[model samples]
Target: MRITLERSNLLKSLNHVHRVVERRNTIPILSNVLLRADGTALAMKATDLDLEITEETPANVEQAGATTVPAHLLYDIVRKLPDGAEVFLATTPDGGTMTIASGRSKFSLQCLPEADFPDLTAGTFSHTFKLTASDLKMLIDRTQFAISTEETRYYLNGIFFHTIEAQGDLKLRAVATDGHRLARADIKAPSGSEGMPGIIIPRKTVGELQKLVDNPEATVTIEVSDAKIRLSIGSIVMTSKLIDGTFPDYQRVIPTGNDKEMRVDCQTFAQAVDRVSTISSERGRAVKLALTDGQLLLTVNNPDSGSATDELAVSYESDAMEIGFNAKYLLDITAQLSGTDAVFLLADAGSPTLIRDTAGDDALYVLMPMRV
Candidate 1:
């Protein structure tokens, strides 16, 4: 394909599309990006078969053509060019090599016939709804840390996305768990998603979507079917096949009627956990929380290492309680807090503890306690 695209625009699009291309591929064309000059824009597409990303940018299309070139190599070449440099990409008729030129630098990339590239049918999207970029990022960032990496439970390797009833209203929720801990967050469901089927978005798709949602003001339109989920933003689109297993019913795990409540500064509590965790040995990753009369003491003890204790003033009036939790797990839950304080509701020492923002009930978190 022959086209002249701004260096910055080409690099920007390539940076996003190249990441979707696997570093190593058994198929030759899989390592390359499909470049098609159509109308007045240049389209760049890359895929690993499981997921695909396509981006379009404004370009001068002197002669409409298409070819496949090494994704990473093209990105690297354009990245090194001087800022504001205009990049000219041209493919010879034989389609054996593609040339890249910017100012004084020039490089030739080996090309493959676009016909050899595996084609994915861009199925007609049945449902489309818009989400603020920042909201989508929030959905992924807050819960992705809990996604299970265990190969045995492949279905738990992604965030379980579904609609749930809360306070007599339906809300879109994202939940992730690795057996030990779980994170759940919710946002008001869009108008068109009332009856949409729940889907388990794979971890990789969650990651790519995070990168694509950099603009908070940018609204992404999402379309989903039984097997596929597609996201469109501006001039970019990402599609992935959803995981096909039934996600465990998460509602049974979120405890109800936890009455004992404790409120503490989220930042201070997180820092206390960080400091005490230092004393925990590599094998035993537990931090004990002892709460009484408006005070919270975090302690970690390791025979080989040492013991640490940090006390912080909190708002708790319930009976004295002591519970143990994994330091990493505590940090993950605490990191989700976006406000000053977090309110934790505890039923007892052995039951799951519920956490939420002290200011409101927009989102809630639950953690199962460990024996100290």
Candidate 2:
């Protein structure tokens, strides 16, 4: 195969697909990316058995053929090449190596037969829908942080996605939890998404999707089956395997009886928590929140180091009480809030506390309290 393409075009497409290839792999072809040159385009594909990404870029094809080469090595070479320079790629007759030439720089990379590259076959999709990039990003960004990293409970490793009837409308919801904390976000369900089966998108796939959906104005097409999912954005397409497990009923964990409400400036409360938690040890990052009539006190105790305290005026109309929470977790949830004020709903020192962003009702969080 022989093809000529601009360095910029090659680098951009390579950057998108190379990340899906693992750095280390037992299978030889898994370490290489498949490149195919056809009529007027070059298609590049990379996979790790679980996830696959493919992208096509316009090119000048002198001959039509396909081969596989080290993905990272090729990307590095193209990245270091002079900008706006035309690149020439040609394979040897024996299909042993491919030559990369641009300006005066040249390199030869070992190649594997294109037939050896594995393909992730996406079966029939049960549902297909389109979502604006902004809406999809909002749903993923809010809930991804709470996905459980524990390997034992494999089901919680990815965000649970499904359509549910809520507030007299069909809503598409994303929910994730790690036992200690839970995050849930929702958007109006798009047409053709009704009655779709709930699916657990694996953690790695969710992370990759988050990076790809950067253009807020663009539209993304999603196709899902029971075992796999495919997302197409512009010239890039990604297919991934879904987790084969059942997600727990998350509604049971949401607190419904929390009566105490405390409203505070979101930025002020977060900064206070950050300052007080500075004296906390890595293992013990709990920060105590003492609530009274119209004031709130934050404290962190670390016998191995020192202690800290910060107080802020808040809008709390409840009896005096003290509750403890993980400072890191609190900061993470607050970072996602959009409004100037954050509202906390509490039942007791030991029960789960519900947190909401005063900006909207689309997102909510639940945090389990710690004993101080």
Which pairs of residues collide in model 2? none
The best candidate by lDDT is 2
Off by over 4 Å in 2: none
Cα lDDT, model 2, residue 147: 98
Question: Taking the tens digit of each residue's C-alpha lDDT, what string does model 2 give over 229-309?
Answer: 999999999999999999999999899999999999999999999999999999989999999999999999999988999
User: Candidate 1's residue-wise lDDT over 1-372, tens digit each?
Assistant: 788989989999999999989898888889999999999999999999989999999999999999999899888888899999999989888989999988888899899998998866767766678888887888888889999999889999999887778888988889998888788888898777787888999988888888888899999998988788989999998989889999998889988889899999999999989999988987788999999999999989999867999999999999999989889888988887888999899988789998897655666778889888
For model 2, what is the error of residue 78's alpha carbon versus the real structure, in angstroms, after optimal superposition? 1.2
Whole-model lDDT values for every prediction: 0.88, 0.96
- Report how far off residue 211 is in candidate 1 (Å): 0.8
Worst 10 residues of 1 by lDDT: 357-366
- After superposing candidate 1 on the true structure, give the runs of residues whose Cα lies further than 4 Å from its correct spot: 122-124
| Candidate 2 accuracy as lDDT | 0.96
Candidate 1: residue 142 Cα off by (Å): 2.2
Model 2 residue 303 CA deviation in Å: 0.4
